[model samples]
Target: MPEAAPAPGAPPHPVAGQEPGGPRVLLPHLRGFAGRLIAVMVLSLVTVVGALAQPLVIRMVVDALADSEPIKGLVAALVALVLGVAAVNAVRDFWLQRVAEGAVRAVRTRLTAHLLRLPVAEYDLRRSGDLLSRVSADTTLLRNVLTTGVFDLVTGAVTVLGAAVVMALLDPLLLAAAGLGLGLGMLCSLIAARWIRPLSERAQARLGEMTSEVERAVSAARTIRAAGAEERESRAIADRARLAYEAGVRVARVRAAVSPLSMLGTQGAFLLVLGVGGARVASGAIGVGDLIAFVLYVFYLVSPLTQAVNAYVQVQTGLGAASRIGEILAIPAEDLHGRGPAPDRAVRTPANGAAAEGADGAPAAVEFDAVSFDYGAGPVLDEVSFTAPHGGVTAIVGPSGAGKSTLLALVERFYDPRSGTIRADGVDVTELSRSQLRSKLAYVEQEAPVLAGTIRDNLLLATPDATREELLAVLDTVNLRGLAERTSKGLDAEVGDAGVRLSGGERQRLALARALLTDAPILLLDEPTSQLDANNEAALRDAIAAVSRQRTLLVVAHRLSTVADADQILVLDSGRVVGQGRHHDLARENAAYHELAARQLLVT
Candidate 1:
């Protein structure tokens, strides 16, 4: 009964001032890292400046040789310049990479935390594979953009600017030719980047598809194998993988042409500078050393220009992935992360259409008043009304999809009813933060999901502070004392993925034990004995009966006999509750109750 997530193929929620698909939302994350980037920039400045000064030093050495002005001194100066550039660059590389990685880590951590905290409905709409892809691959784009892309752009821009200034000072005509060459390279890079951007986006999306397929197959491996679908699934996954491969190839195809195109421009500039400057040198318009220095500066311009073009290409690719990441950030988290005061320990009487309290002093634990809801498309529950008093057991019996599970889910506030209200202790549940309300109840889902961990880890998930003695006591309540003793590691024994290592009965019992450890005032159990054999079922009936004595219990009971003595029995069919009374009374009078009892061979 978790709220339905957005449709799997639905477009991401839209952002203001942007087209349907966008990625420039990284400004906030970048703003936080500005200070670190400033430090990197200072070091980068020194390295680039040192590198730019090299051509000037060579110019001096060339002139000194022509004038016989002690070439040794100039050579030593050049060597010192090289060492300085190397040292600054090394330091710059370290801090830049570290800061970039730290920024990526920050984004990943925040995005993942936000994802998990999103409302259950959001999760239902989104596929786990796409979510995983955002966390793993999409965030990686930030690293590339921040580190490699930024690094190249920074150095390339500085070197180009520095080279331009020196070449212009040496000869204005040579500078003009170099500019013409760089302009052409920039044009080619822009075209290639434009082509690669869309392809990169397609490739990243395909990668997400591949991830989702693998996850779907792995999680349902047993079902797929039972259905003899190994070949089918393999082909499906292969198809996705092939699509991703083709997208990557398309991106590579565009990217492959970028470097060469950029190189062509640089080479053209080199020839133009050589021809034009050579003419000037012969016409005695410039010194031989000056012409040589101008050519060296042009060479410096070429490398930086080529680097800038390649870095631009990388930026475009990163933006493609970033668009996907931005889409996730855009989806709203329905306040699950909000903080509210702890759920009131002493339950209050139902207020605001809540179930009125009975003669007992105990407060109403759950009250549903004409609650109507749907997964998304149609009404699953229509005008469903019920009340489970503050304490004692209330059992819900219904045919499959009678919305029995949905009722419990609404009471738990997994999804707010589309119409009507639910109250916990007279206070509207919607008024309380999700965490606050959930903290007061312990739940055992129908499937009784068990995480992959030791028995202790699974139990401690409910009550982390519970001591060893307390843990054993709860395990005893669920008839798991023997399980605890039989396993090689007792409470520490491993429960494989989805508790596959444990028997079905053991998993269910362990889940019940974990819930018991919560010590919450209210307990919601769905089909608690569905997986149990006769012996375990009978044993669990006793356990449930005993546990009910101390807490408010709402159970979706599949077997009518199990709830024959429930304080209240709610019989449901198609959505509405058909009857409510003692199980024996319902068995005697309610048509639906009698039919269900007859089907399950239960006589109350």
Candidate 2:
């Protein structure tokens, strides 16, 4: 299989599990964007200063009117204050948006890169839809946190602090009122935080479940249609979606109650400030203008206080998103480094290399030394052992569940043997790098998958650099050159998805041509002629014979005719090597082989 290309601008470091606590994970991403964040903070500070100055300016205008000072000068000061606030706010808004977008882009790139590096085994157990939600929906929530949440947090903090300081200087009695209301609001917010974390986590998980259901329906649309299960599938999807909706509503209820309760605290503070400040003004302890300024500052303080509560809520949501991303990143990726031979090692052909040894050091040939495996269940191959020598084809014939395909998978190292080892050319296959072993072996699977591309692309899958002349030679060897020429685009014609445009025999021939083009020293054929008619089977057998003359071949045969001429045949029953000898010899001596031949059950 071809490896996918790496995405551009991806982060170099790995992103595994979440930090020890939620705060630690957030700190890194925040620190990474600290420079831009600082710029935003500075601009926000400027905006707050401009906003706070408005009340002082209002006080100046009020005092000037009371003293009957020059109207023109006061009017000029008001106009300049208005323009200054507008200019500062405009610049602050522009940079804030720019900084938020940049932070989100960086985060998305890192998350996507980490996800792509996850191991295949992880994918086997994970649902596509759930993973999709982490990449899409969760990331969107994070973007809101970076943009809106961060801005609100910074501006809100500054506004509240500045208002408090001004109020304390104006009237200590009125300041007490603001502090009491703020303390109560903080208490309420802290209580809401307790519920927010768990609710947000549950809501995100439910969203993932809903996404999974939708993805399942789309992926199996044809199956659902053929079985008339549309309504059933729809109901299943709706059930998951309803669960997510309920979870969201639960979070919404908390948020709804919290916001108003926060506003109520602010309202209570406003009433106290008004009553106390009004009495002080009536007693002539403070001027009317100062009281007016103090009240305006109190309103300013409430804005940030309300925003602070909302920011806390947003942080909880972001924590939920980060936890989901961390779960995917934590799956262990395939380890690429080990004690195996380097991939650049030269091919070891028998004619030019060391003598091959069997498990017993007797110079026998390919041997499976007590090999065993399992595909998440109990062992499929248990203590199985066998040998196939060079200069002849060794055919392994078996019943359907005899672990035939599993054995091939071990040799290819698509999976490693759980116990014992497999020796090819006297060296344990586990000792060789995956690329080194695979490059020397030509494998033709039972299904003969062909990708969605031109016929030329499929043939070049094994030997991408094959010359045009080399490609044509292999095509003729497999008797597919005629078919290739018949298409309007010849070798360039689109093969359609999984080669749907081609007949079964054509696909098999295409697979054969691909294997032939590699010119590997070891051929592993998995029922190569299963899809062919007699004539096509004969052609395939002939092609195999011609190629096997220069390579060691292992043929997994279901038809007696396909392996009858083999130098040796290994009869397998229930995952063990039951009989091993020449085809006719086994048929005469082994009951299972004899019964299989008599019933004409061979694929050929």
Candidate 3:
């Protein structure tokens, strides 16, 4: 497997005690900020108390006016109550915003760190863009819902309860008439939430697809344009966007039910209150001011009722996004038994000329023991065993599908073999944590990728502690000193995205320099010279030859000339090694090796 950025939407493992996509998975993130949550709740209580007081102040004013006694004092109290409501609500909103932002930041940070720790096999099953969307856009929904949905859900309930108590105090018959009808509509809206939930989740997923399409298209823009496939790619992305749009439309259609239901309940309450309260007034059962307050209380239900309905819808939307994020969290991480670093006894400090100890204390760098593996589709490595000699160059050459790269992946521990053990020194790679095992090797991938940063940043990616002189030495080794001289900021010069500013050969050499700078004893190079021209190739071969004298080098090469003089050559075909020996010896003894060398005129 190739090194990849974090991926999205692989079939995730289930969260504990929850069906795979259930909203219960959201509890951990919500629980993380208990303090901020408490603060928000306290502020909400203040807001609700202040809001509930306004209705009673109106009642006091209306009763005072009816009695023709001290209207001015009651009016002043009403003004004070209204200002208090505004003040408390403003404070509540501020706290809710802070809590929402903090929660999402922590979640995003944890998700990103977890992604880096995942086994490489996970990357094979997920699309990078989709994973990025989950981290970015999908997580944003969680924050919004946390603020709008969770907050509203809490405050709305308090407002409803306080309003209910006041309404009962104003007039029981009027309250009964309004309450029953309003409760029925709100209950029905919540029932519709079940239908709306999946649609909201699907909309987020489809949007992830759009993000995936866009990322692929952008990354391969030059290839698409060169091949004149822009229209085809654009159409594909547009189609995904269309599906996302349709999914969003369905969510909207479901959510639209909330407003009309709230409106229906509001209208229903107004009619019931007007008719019942007017009857009470005409019957001289209650004062006109009392009837007005009863109607006012009935209208008060509309504001919080609408907020509650809207908040519930937002919660459903949030759960939809949470389901996607949960899948990522649910997937088992690729930790080595969740253990810490290798014991101090097993630690191999890298000196200038280090060689890992094999079983029986034999001098070997890496050993693959009876390794057999497949990538779900079919077998890629079959009963393969090889030992990379310490302080020497061993080259693996094979046809396109012969599992040469797969062998390198196993050594890197990207995926473990099904029926074998890979050892760094005498210890099984599985016995060490991922960080521990990777510490022993420096791997350069076939397509030599550079990250978005300055030239110096890319150089020091693996071995951050290397001195400036050491950095200059590796750059010079790869014949990239001229690059340092040419750039305006020298090592500090920006490389642009993936080092696009550098030529193909420069990228490959820079990647090689990064690997060389590492203290790792084993160097694994996968077609590192694939992009180089004759001049750079010769320089790299010399560099490789010089490096191997001090460190173990295992290289996978397709082009025969690059590895023609390797100390040992392993020739593979159809997932099995058919030959292994010095280059000239293999050419004479093995038919497959002979044919490969003959094609390259290496044995003609």
Candidate 4:
């Protein structure tokens, strides 16, 4: 049985050193796009130059018109300046979009690689949907931070400052009058923007929860329908959606406030500039042409201010997403380089108080000494010990929740034992690099999950370079050859999602065949024949017997017939090894083994 998940409302397992800084988490990812940013900056400069020159040309045209002189040259210059700025703006937008997309791709690649390498324990605590959200939705949020957030903030600031300088040179009095309304409008927008960060954080977190709920419902759609609980599940999912909607509404409320406040300030400043400049014109302090040019510069300043405000808000939302993404990235992966037990450390005997040795008294292929484990709730395995010696089948039989599967999990090092030591061939399991250790054993899970792909794809998962002959050989070994033969594409036939197109028995055999293709000396099978019929079960037993001739096999079997001919059988009850011996010997001599055999009607 699988370990139970944490109870509802339990605190999430904390990842050490994973605190995320706002927006800054993306800085390292942006390093590769420095060239693109430089190009954007150059374009922005050209835009600023064009903007400054356009108003000057307009002023020249106005003055020439008042003088009644031919103004064709000035009009042409103004038109040229307008077209040039528009062309530069278009190019600037293209480069910024590329930079945004490239940055998002790099981030997603890094996130995917890191999530795959995370320890199995991490998956237990985190939902697949939540992790996927960080990769897809969260990384998408980061895209806007690059395009509209950071770059816009930078370019807008430069443009705003440039316009301000020109406005001050044009007329200090008019500049001062414009600053008043703009400052008030900016103050209102900044206050509104402050609420965006916290609201965005809440919104993204709620979305993650909603995504996890959706994934759970979809994956278990069959189960829900069989239980006639479709409406119940739908209602549960709707509840999650409603919470997400409420959170999003809150974020939208704040974002909506920002836009209107920014607009109000900009329009107020524009009006103030027009009023003041007109008064200056009337006083003869400035000509009508000067008033018109100053009014245009005021608009230029206002445009950047508006963009800067909007960008600030987007940056806040991106940072909110960064916090979620960082949480996953901050987790410490399984220590693949751990240095285990010193050479001088004494190796303890198996908990059975007898050495697990072969004919020559050499150490077993795999041995456990007083190992115990708990899954945060309570003990799943308690001081259990066993051995799978070289070149034979060692079967583990037990009632449900007897920690039958936990033993294989330990050997695989998916989770470390809470106490005691496990060794493979006299070397501490922890001492070997995870890659080196896993390469030594091939494991078939109980559910025998088959990924969505072709038969050829699934077969080549572990041994990617296995030739066609080798693939055919393993399929024949596990009696899965007929599956490929029935398909029109042979080995390339699609298995559909999780091998849904195949029968339960075929999925299990395919999983076994995949494991069998590996040259690993130890094969760990978890209820490999659980879904097989009587005939398929017997054939699988024969396959196991044949493979045992060359490699040690640890089979976790529920059916007594599956392991009736095993060299040794370990009977577990309540996480303790209650019996051990050949199946017939244990059935006759061990009380716990006898009860289990009688229950299965294997003994009279």
RMSD of each: 3.9, 6.8, 4.7, 3.0
Candidate with top TM-score is: 4
lDDT of 1 by residue, 316-335 (tens): 78877777777777776656
For each candidate, what TM-score against the reference? 0.92, 0.78, 0.93, 0.95
Clashes of 4: 0
> After superposition, which runs of candidate 1 have C-alpha atoms over 4 Å from their true positions?
1-12, 15-35, 337-355
Q: Which stretches of candidate 4 lie over 4 Å from their true place?
A: 6-18, 341-356
User: Model 3: which residue pairs collide?
Assistant: 8-131
Q: Give the TM-score of candidate 3.
A: 0.93
RMSD of 4: 3.0
Clashes of 2: 3
Model 4, position 522: C-alpha lDDT score? 97
Best-to-worst lDDT order: 4, 3, 1, 2
Question: Which is better, 1 or 4, measured by lDDT?
Answer: 4
Q: Local error of candidate 4 at 96, Å? A: 1.1
Quick one: ranking by TM-score, best first? 4, 3, 1, 2
Candidate 3 lDDT over 287-336, as tens digits, reads 88787777766666778887888888888888888788877877767775
